[model samples]
Target: MDYLRVAGGRVLRPDGRVERADVAVDRDEGTIRAVGAPDEVDDAVGEPPGEALDADGSLVIPGLVNAHTHVAMTLLRGYADDKPLDPWLREDIWPAEAELTPDDIEAGAELGVLEMIRSGTTAFADMYFAMDRVADVVDRAGLRARLGHGVVTVAKEDADARADVEESLAVARELDGAADGRIRTAFMPHSLTTVGEEYLREGVAGAREAGVPVHLHANETTDEVDPIVDERGERPIAYAESLDALGADDFFAHGVHVDDSEVDRLAEAGTAVVHCPASNMKLASGMAPVQRLREAGVTVALGTDGAASNNDLDVFDEMRDAAMLGKLAADDAAAVPASAVVEMATAGGADALGLPGGRIEAGAAADLAVVDLDAPHLTPVHDPVSHLAYAAHGSDVRHTVCDGEVLMRDREVLTLDAAAVRERAANAASDLVERVESA
Candidate 1:
């Protein structure tokens, strides 16, 4: 009979409407039990049980979902910049990553999860090394994640490449449904160009056999798309289809260079694309055709990619960047309106990841973010949705909840010691840089 109540707030509904309500949670079940006015919610609960969160004078929206990110890459934040994907990865990122230790991975992941919780993100999809370490962070932080080990098989001996592919499949099998069912898993093939055709087909087949979805980088830049077209005589999505990788359950990250034909293929296959607007802009990776894809019935979600590229894991920033970039990419002010970006960050992400928390409704997972609108910047509220998409920053988040558990309240994180995690991560980042330089 454990219960938690979020009282006296305006709850944002799934369809962009808001209403003054109190949301009640069955903490034992970790699902929302009721969402209505105080009296109605109280009546539905019958008796007050455990605790209540005062959401007075705030907006209660579903917790943000970050669909794609390399969480442990937080150690590389600001480590490399102003280079395109290949050069950046080859000269700076890959070399540095080759020096990462399990301990370093843990520290960076803890910091990333801490930032995400602080920013009101309750769920994320992460691809990186030492995924077991990442899963540990997600468990301790009390957030949800879809995690996987990224497999890169280029220029490797057959034995080594097979081992890498097997490692990805093994990690996916081992980690799925971990962390009290808060963690799911996917098979990650890095990208089309990085992993060879045989490995991609074998890995994807193994994933399908295990009933797991696949995730990968696709059509991220002209450089990535050009080679595939030159060799295969088809677009990236079409080549992905040839590998048997594109499916309703699969999602690709950073479809920044997808053409109209590729967009059509994505829509028809029911695959999703995670648009990392900040990462794309920072790396000059070109803008994703988000408006066109959505118009063609493609489900587009939002992500920050990683702290290294995005410089932050704030879905608020992603929302603003998506709206602004979508318009510029389409040459129309009406393209990718504020409401659409908001949906992409929340419901769109949930839909893409095949998870259940993204709207304030009964029987949904009790994941939510509380935004304090009492500040001067948020003053004279005309449209909350507009402010959320265009004006809000992650700092405005006052509380974050996931699975009926309060992860943060009053801007204070409860699940982990933020100050301690930052210190550890800083130390780890310094050590990693030294090791990379020495190597």
Candidate 2:
């Protein structure tokens, strides 16, 4: 089998301390086989006979994982910056989205993937409409993703809502293992506000049958806070538990309104939560109980949410925001150590998504990111994890490889046509902007 060796970088292997090593990958099988000094590569495969990427003494980590996103919103970025979640969705985003065609969705998804690859994200969990197009774009970009067919019950309290859920469930089933097993599918009932108990139950049942994940937003705002409390006579987590939907594989995003009780449910149910710190702060959504969740043994990862809300799809920015906001929320400067946050952005994210990735180790898929440690922002690094979490920006990501395929190298993308993506994004945004402004 042809082998590729990456030499001269400091790699963070799963069970070892960060050390300089050469990593060899069996490209034909898409698995990493050898990771040691360059000399060991020759032993593993004669002459390491293939492409050799010189890491140049940079810091290499498992590719950054973005656990939750609505990628097609790239067309809606910066549309309604200062508005609350509900109003922003209704007044700006939803209306603009109403005008989107499949081509528009493809353009936006392509733009989002380009941004993600450039920023070092190897895999992400995405929930949006027109998901076939999302799948197509993500597949073409050579990125790993768990796609969620985001379905909202047409009428919150009607039986029709259950039917809508079933429709989405069917779609998820059809696409669950599509895209060469690199893309997975999930059930996504938009939110408690949009889909009622029946649809939620249907989604839970659907997920149980497919053995896949369920991605959804929960307790993101106080607008949802009181309604869930009044209707269910309990918090969102309690209501979710009543429906048997919370679990490790069922990743819930934006737990901003969840209280101690909900945190307890998450812990007991082994549910994972994705903290979209930048989106929460930008939308003025209350900070999530991240410290409480962590202490309660809940898996917490970081996410950029979407370009529309965060106005940027940068996971490096997400990591920094998560760390700062995590400390601020707990009223302790050390609430989340930089090292821990880096883990949350990397390994923790992979765990939340149930993906076999997020570390440089033998038997692991060759998914990784390389950073130019020689850069100005990374100079004289006191702690590699700290520098990665706090100082690095997405622009500093030098390379991104996913599933043994190089999506980007030296800040140049290899998978998707970035220039075409940019052009289509511009045209799509112009159309959406005109629709929203006129509305």
Candidate 3:
């Protein structure tokens, strides 16, 4: 059989158990063929494998998923800081975004993809404009993604607003099955406050017809929620339900300010929420009731939001932040435990995005990350799961694999030229800042 074997590592099982195991992947099908002891994997495969990844001294976990992000915003990392969400968008982010060209999007996307690959993130959901360029990067970089064009119709001519909605639906329709089924698509309205109800209703209908899920920002801040409550006499989740925007397949970003009713509604609707702890804290957005959401059966995933707000695309840091913030928000040290955060980063993220590859069992998608435990920060090896939540950094990733393809091996990315991507993104960011300043 032609397969790729990841041998000699402690595999994190689906039941939160860690055991010494070897994983065999069907390279042709991009799925796991077996996950067990070396002899067991050899028995299942019935022959020697075609390739192998050295996993000694490493912990093999399902590839980390960044459930929500504006990946092309990597060019804006550290560009604007110390501001609330509304002002940050209006004063700095929006103006700079208006100046972005497709080339700039591609450059920034390449940089973000490189960072994700290096940091062991194999899949993500990206909401941004010029997403075709981002999809192109994902295609070449051997990563999985749910791609969408973010639509905002807050201040536009009716015709222009309608056109933006149409573009989002069109992009979703055209890109759903791209990248050999590694890429999915979503209908994305930027946010409740940033989009008109008419456009949202129309776009969501189109997306339902296209059989794609919807993604949006909701209840990110009290400022965002108060308007909906005051105008519609309902919370943002209820408002979203009114627009047919909440669905079992749909996922929302933030949900920071959601109350008990909103959380229950999300659970009842089977909608998922991606908690961007770093971005929320950076923008001073209210803390998400992650423990409550999870307790209410809402799928809680972790996201970096965007490099601009997160300052990096590192899911490891996000896991740590989510655990810390969840405890603080609930005032319970056991609110978000290491196991919970680990599951959120993996299975919850994949489930939220409606993508595959969150588990390391047979027949699952072959997406995995190998974390080296040889560092000083990871010493004593008391509990790998605990270390993953509190100590491990993205730099500790020794390898990243997606679709049975090794994107990074031994800290060197193979799918894209890391140095070249960095240089291009740096140049693009500089040019973009200059243009924004000149304009």
Candidate 4:
């Protein structure tokens, strides 16, 4: 019967309504038990059994979910930038990554998790390497995550490629349901272009047998799509479907170069696409057809990709970029409205990950973010939802709660030591650069 209450804030409800309310969480189960006006919730809960967070002058919204990321890439932030994806990976990122150790991965993950928590992200789906370290960081930081080791097989012998595939599957199986259910696992092939047909099919088959969903990069650029279409005689999505990779539980990252038919196929499969607008823009990758995907009944979520590409893991920035780019890409002023972008950052992401906590209501998981609207930039709050999409920044988040536990309060992260994490990651990055250069 442990309880924690968030009192006196404007709560964003499931249906996009905003009301002054108090949210009561059953700490034992980490679920919202009551949400109503302060006096009403007080009467319903008969006093918080443990603690209460004062949320006056704040807007309480569901914690944002980052649907796709490479969390440990925090070590590589600014290591390689202003280059396209292929050369950027081949020349800079891969060589540096080959020098990383498990400690390096943990340090980078800790830094990434610190960034996400401070920025009001409660959960994320990550496709990266050394995911056991990633899961450890997520659990320790009190955030929920779905993690998988990214598998790349191209330019390798069959034995080496098969070994990579096996390792990816092994990591997924070993890590699923770890960390008191705070961690989930997925099968992540780096990309359709990077993974050969036989390897992709085998990985997907093993994932299906293991009951894990698939996550990967697909159609990220015209370069990736043209070659696939030239060789397969169809779209990238068609090739993915041919290998039985399309499913309701599966989600893809960066479907930027997808065509209308590909969007239709994704919608038909009930699959989700995570839009990483900042990363795509920074890499000079083409804009994703977010409006078309949503119009086709596909669920679209927002992401920051990874710090190395986006240069920062900020979902608020992602929302703003998504709105601006969607309109320009579609050449319509109303292509992606503010509300749509807000939904993509919150509920859309949670839904895509098959987790709860996107909505503020009874029986929902108690994952929430508190934004200090008292700032001058947030003045004259014409519309809270509009503010979330068009005006807010990560620094405006004053508090973060996940699983009914207060992780950050008043701009201070409680579960993670931010200063220590930043120092460790800085040292790791410095050493990694030296090692790669020396080699």
Candidate 5:
């Protein structure tokens, strides 16, 4: 059997146990063939694997999933900072975005994809315009994603607003099975308040007909939620439900300001919430009641939101931030434990995005990250899980593998030229800012 082996590492099992194991991957099928002892994997494969990745002195964990992000915003990283969500988007982000070209999107997407590979994120959900270019980057970068065209219709003419909704649906339908099934598509409305109710209803209906899930920002801040509540006489989640936008398959970013009733509705609908702790803090968006949401049987995931607000796309940092912020929000140190945040970064994220590659078991998507535990910050690893949530950094990743393909090995990315991507993104960002300024 043609397979690749990840040899001699402590594997983080689905049940959270760490054990010495070797994982065999069926490269042809892009699935985990076996995950067990060295002899056990050999027995399962029926032959020695032709290729192997050294996992010695490392811990093999499922590749992180950035469930919600505007990846191409990597070009806008640090372009605008120290502002609230509404003003930040209106005053800086939207102006810069209006000046973006498809080429700029591609350059920025390559930069974001390169960062994700280097940092061990194998899958993410991106909601932004010019997503065809982002999808191309994902295909070439050997990553998984749920890509969508973000539609915002608040300030547009009726015809233009309808056209935006149609474009989102068209992009979703056209790109559903692209990249050999590694890329899925979603219908993304920019946010509950940023989109009109009629367009949202139309877009969600079209998405349902096309058999795609919906993603959006919801209840991110008091400014966002108060208007919906005041106008609709109900909460944002209820307003979403009224539009038929809430569903088992749908996921929302930032449920930061959601209350108990909204939490109940989310739990009942099986809708997932992607907590962006760093982004929330950066924008002064209220802390998400992550522990409360989880206690209500809601599936909670972690996201970096976008590099503009998050300043980075590192899921390890998200995990650490989620744990810390959750504890503060709940006023309990045990509110979000290491195990919980780690699971959120992996399984919860995959489940939220309706993608694969959050576990390392047989028949699961072969997405894995090897974290080198030999660093000074990680010395005397009392519990690897603890280290993952509290101490680990993206640079700790030694190897990143997705879909049975090695994207990065030994701290060097193999799929894309790191230097070239950075250079292109820098140039694009400079050009974009200049255009926005000149306009």
Candidate 6:
């Protein structure tokens, strides 16, 4: 509740590099009023009457944006493990989610938001049901997000799916630009394997008309392709192109099986992919051809998928996997360098979501995460960016600020009560386990 002066640190600027500087977060306007050398702005705000956070020359980077996720599934993080995507959804996930009341969803989402804030994820995209409750919890947490009305179809021609589409639109209209521009809605049609072509087209049209981004699951697995192409005589990207939906506003979740032609088309069309590595590996979905896509000049972002799949919304863990997997998948030791990995988690993810964030500049949103440079693994830092993308864990994030509000400071949380939220989520997960077992 005081003026925040973060001094004596290495700040990651807008130019994809780091420099020595300090920042004063103007809580009144929820923006960064001044940034300069340690004392350059000290006199700008007469007397510095608020709390002063000592930076002590640590490294600061913009908070990460998780481009795709289902955070409410935090309750189901490890529920259905070691199963293929189809059986995992058919036998376990959907049934469990069906039993979840709106209250249950709110509790889980609250916990998920708390965890993400502490771990330096300032924003994320979520595709889930009961999004009204999700919005309520997100507003309470004081973070930024892109939420969606979740959809899945069992029939090729179900008019009821149209009603679900309407419901999602209603949610979007009510929640778009909520919480001081921290929350917006994207149209989510589940996936190609789950929804038919007509529904996907309808959803895409609605999103395009509404001037919002469309989030879809594409090429997540080869198993998902048989039904779609066999039924529609085209791959997912081709189907989207035929519908005139492949554009900068469309965000595809996974591209593990997108062919070379599709990558070329995606790069040319300016569509982006949100790679979810942990979920792909855990479900034994083939590794997404991220190296090829990047080489094709496609914009690539990283995500944790969902708690039900990867089981946690930890962006730091995802970055590490992406860095290593990108290198190994290319059979080269330099596919995604440290700087590239950092950009994927920050700026690249922002570009994917169509948000005005992912950089620490005077005119940009005040979204940042500060790490303790004194950590054992991060000592003797030859390159701060390298240390951040490789050595620094989520636990090392000492502070996280989004939209100029300090969500967490000095490894302590402020936006929500972490202890109480964890207790409620634990109770909810226990009930879920009992229900899943008895059923």
TM-score, cand. 1 vs. native: 0.99
Per-residue lDDT tens digits for candidate 2, residues 1-439, read 7777777898876753688888887777777878888787668767645776668858888888999899999888877789889888887777788788888889989999999999989989998888889988877898888887787875345766766677668767877666677888788888877777777887888788878777789999999878888877888888887777886688899999888878888888888999999999988998987888999999998889989889888999998998899999999998887777788888889889887678888888888888888888788877777788899888887888887888897889998778888998999889867766776
- Estimate the TM-score for candidate 4: 0.99
Candidate 6, residue 386: the lDDT equals 83
User: Of models 1 and 5, which has the larger lDDT?
Assistant: 5
lDDT of 1: 0.94
lDDT of candidates 1 onward, in order: 0.94, 0.84, 0.95, 0.92, 0.95, 0.83
lDDT of 6 by residue, 1-439 (tens): 3567777788988777788888887776666767788667776665664866667768888889899998889999878799989899888898898788888898899988988988899989999989989998888888889999878866534778778877776776778998878898888888876876677777777777887777888898888877767888888788878866788867889888898889998999899999888898888887787878888988889899888788778788888888888887778887888787788899888888887678887757778888888877888989998887888878888888888788898888887888999999989988977877787
Off by over 4 Å in 5: none
How do the residues 102-175 of candidate 1 rate in per-residue lDDT, one tens digit apiece?
89999999999999999899999999989999999999999999999999998899999999999999999999
- Return the clash pairs for model 5, or none: none
TM-score against truth, every candidate? 0.99, 0.96, 0.99, 0.99, 0.99, 0.95
The list of candidate 2 runs beyond 4 A from truth reads: 154-163, 436-439
Candidate 5 lDDT (Cα, 0 to 1): 0.95
Residue-wise lDDT of candidate 4 within 87-151, one digit each (tens)? 99999998998999999999999999999999999999998888888888888899898889899
Give the TM-score (vs. native) of candidate 2.
0.96
Q: How far is candidate 4 from the true structure (C-alpha RMSD, Å)?
A: 0.9
Clashing pairs in 2: none
Worst 10 residues of 6 by lDDT: 45-54
Q: Over the full model, what C-alpha lDDT does candidate 2 score relative to the true structure?
A: 0.84
At residue 401, give the lDDT of candidate 3: 92
